[model samples]
Target: MASLHAFANPARFLKIARPLTGWLFWTGAALIAFGCWAGLTQTPPDYLQGDSVRILYIHVPTAWLGMGGWSGIALSSIAYLVWRHPLANVAARAIAVPGAMFAALCLMTGSIWGRPTWGTWWQWDGRLTSMLLLFFVYLGYIGLARADREQGGDGRIPALFGVAGSVLLPIIRYSVVWWNTLHQGESIGLASSTIDGSMLWPLGFTLAGFSLFFAAVVLMRMRDMLARARNEARLRRMARA
Candidate 1:
């Protein structure tokens, strides 16, 4: 796409990303604080689930970012493989750590939510198990990318792996539907949700906040990678001189 190429130049990308980074990070932090406060203190408890339902404010966003992170990797991987765009590869590598962290957070928060709602600390349910698999997939991508870099290999292998890892995304999404599981069926929809309005608004802030924060992190990582590359190139030049 024309838009992707426009920012493909690392210099151009950094110019734009640098300004947005601080804004995104601070705004996201503010929203997270406010959203958590509101979800914990302002909203009424669910008649059935009570205050434990508050964790959804955090749990849902982590799960979303966990899956969303892989989606970014797959897309970036496609761009890198198809166009040989270097920044696309940078993006895929940058997303790995945060994606993995979010996936781990999702599992942790899900367990906390489960203990109260499901009457257990853990379950081998479809959604939970698939999400755990996604976490490991993130780990694999991170390690694979590092190994590829250290060996002086072209990034295609990791890009290919990124593409393949996407197979798990759809499986994770539909796991609850395909199986009768402890995890509840999807309650949110495009136009409506089973959740009441008061209990739901904080989720909006948390999701938006976390997404912004994730973008900031990826950009920071990309910039760091670019700086390292530049430094290495300079060192190589000095050695030859």
Candidate 2:
């Protein structure tokens, strides 16, 4: 909490983030490269779904990230609202687009994987229905934030909506437990040997890589947002002059 308070200052964060971006960027790239190779080429075919299961390597990670990204936004929104953290607001704004994109990827890849496996392009199952709601929430958050930016005021309105939208995550997660679904329940968990060890490692790496990818993009976007803010301020000053 103390560290978050310290870093919530934009000037302090800029000084630190600029130096780390190079290393973080390369690390994210390397992880994605290794994860892609491991997922596509090294991992053995599934006995049940065969090569089709390969899509899980991408679909699962993206789905996880989509949810994870929302969690970040919600957390940041709380920090911004409570502590008036400028950096938190910036992060919330930056993450919205990428989160939505990842959600779309999850849906699209899942759709592709479903056709062959389930013989249908879409399903109204609990998980699928909740996931669709999640995607719309992402869209709504983005729209609200962008609209706030256009309106020339504090971005808190959209941030509040973002925090509220995160409520859907728990519902999406428990939907399978509450009702029947075409989508399978939890994949990687203790006491469950559903996925073999060999395949699990690559999937794990892919998840890590996707997470780092999200972090990198959010950081970059945050920097861009800051730069735009600075530029807009300068432009307004000149206009006043």
Candidate 3:
């Protein structure tokens, strides 16, 4: 908590974020490349999924980030609303675009994976539907944030929405369990994974790579936003002078 507030000063945050940004971006890109290479070339095709199993590398990560991204937003929003952490709103807004993107990618990749495995390009399965709704939620948050800024309102409006949107998170997670859906139940868990070791290793790499990439992107966006806000403040001071 003290550490989080320490970086609340935009200047201090930038001090750390600037150097770290390039390292994270480059490292994440390298890991992603390596992960994809390993996933494609090193891993054997699943006896059940054939070559299509390769999509799991991309699909699983996107899905995790899609949900995890919102988790970030929710936490940021909470920080903004409850603690009034200065950069929290910027962080939440920064997270929206990439989060939505991952959500959309999840849908696209899921459809591709489904077409081969489930014999269809799309389905209204519980998991799929809830995920689609999550994508919509991301869009809504992005739109609301935009509108709030245009109206020159306090950041609280979108911050509230970010908190409210989190309600969808649990629903998406449990959709498969609650309904009879074509989407598979959770294969990975904190303690154990149902996935075979041969295939699971590459997935680990891809997941780590994409998550790092996502964090790098979010940091970049936050830095950009803070700079813009600082510029706007300077301009306002100039106008007053």
Q: Candidate 3 overall Cα lDDT vs. reference?
A: 0.93
Please write out the lDDT profile of model 1 over residues 1-241, one tens digit for every residue. Answer: 8887899988899899899989999999999889998999999999999999999999999999999999999999999999999999999999999999999999998898888788998978889999999999999999999999999988999999999999999998888889888899887888999999989999999999999899999989999999999999999999999
Compared with the true structure, what per-residue lDDT tens digits does model 2 show for residues 1-241?
Answer: 8987788778888888887767677786788788778888998988978899888878988889889889999999998899888888999988988898998899999999999989999988888888889999988888888888898869789878978898899998888778888888787766776788777777777787778778888888999999998999999999999
Q: Once superposed on the true structure, which residue ranges of model 1 sit more than 4 Å away at CA? A: none
Candidate 2, position 46, lDDT: 85
- Candidate numbers, best lDDT first, in rank order: 1, 3, 2
Q: Write the per-residue lDDT of candidate 3 for residues 109-183, one digit (tens) a residue.
A: 999989989999998888999999999999999999999998997789899999999998999999888889999
Q: What is the C-alpha lDDT of each candidate?
A: 0.93, 0.86, 0.93
TM-score of each: 0.98, 0.95, 0.98
Tell me model 2's lDDT, rounded to 2 decimals: 0.86
Residue pairs in steric clash, candidate 3?
none
Worst lDDT 10-window in candidate 2: 185-194
Q: Which window of ten consecutive residues has the lowest lDDT sum in model 3?
A: 1-10
Model 1: per-residue Cα lDDT at residue 120: 98
